[model samples]
Target: MSNPLFKKINIFLKVNEQTIDSYFNANDPAPIYKRQLSQEFEEYIMNYAPSIKRYSTVTYKLNCVNESDKEYLDPLVHAIRRHFSLKKSIREAEFKKFKKRNWVLLTFSLIVVMFFQGVMPLIFNVEHRIHSAFSNALDVFSWVILWKPIEKLIFYWNPFLKEISIFDKLINAPIIIVGEKKEVAPMEQEYAA
Candidate 1:
């Protein structure tokens, strides 16, 4: 029998690889790539716990909220959906391309974001706040540097919690309390016959 833990890790990696490829394919080299990368990072977190999947789905649902305002929301939804769909098209050709120079691609992305968010602002005399550029660089760097460690922690923490039930109790106690509580209403319910 296959270990469930290993099965989950495999799924997590597969989904992330798909999400990355989708974002990479977009021809326009805008600041949005950084956002997409950050999003994929969150998706990696959700792969382990099924309950947390709602958070990711809610993000997609937000795209559908203003359907009548197609002029604004349509492009945003198309871009998001296109990036996600590319994950499904992964194959030997794409894997080979990705394997050869994943680091190079990451570095190029950082350079593009820095140039636009950093140098371009100066060149164009745009007086945007410094926080915009700094935040973008920081986010990209954090995601790249932190991805592996975060994955390992999420993968192992579940089993570790199972082994040490004490930690589990501590973490789960609040959830249990909230689940058991009843709130009293100011007004009593009245039924008319």
Candidate 2:
């Protein structure tokens, strides 16, 4: 029987997680993705894309890759490409949304913190007990309000960035669609073992 048009895709994986499971079950991507991402990131990507099955060592086949029909292969590739593009756009949108929140939070926090630090003391004339109490309250409140934005900007941004990077890589991944699997000779098989 003749083989399909594309086969033997050798994926040069850059997202080196600790184990194969981590790579496949990209729930959190940490400490691979670490503090940069969440389990939701994995869902966001996988929700639209099908799972890739491994064909051999360091090689994976897309859906219906073993089929000899050229038409079957093309649709899978197109679907995969479309999904990658769609997911990348989603991530970009999410990143922009988070960035906007960070800016807004930062701006509001600056305003409130200034009011507490600069105006509160003046309002209480700096020497009163009320002044000290307000100062302490302001310090604590500022930390609370600003904490999320700080975390989002400093710690949470990396994973989305990494996801985008991975998506880009997959989108541009070198796809080698081989004809079919070749039978191995006894000598080569023994050597491989």
Q: What is the TM-score of each candidate against the true structure?
A: 0.21, 0.59
List the candidate 1 regions with Cα displacement exceeding 4 Å: 1-49, 52-60, 63-70, 91-193
Predicted model with the maximum TM-score: 2
lDDT for 1 (candidate 2)? 40
For model 2, residues 26-68, the per-residue Cα lDDT tens digits are: 4534332122222443464444232222221123243222344
TM-score of 2: 0.59
How does model 2 fare in lDDT?
0.57
lDDT of each: 0.39, 0.57
Q: Which stretches of candidate 2 lie over 4 Å from their true place?
A: 1-68, 181-193
Q: How far does residue 120 in candidate 2 sit from its true spot (Å)?
A: 1.3
Clashing pairs in 1: 18-87
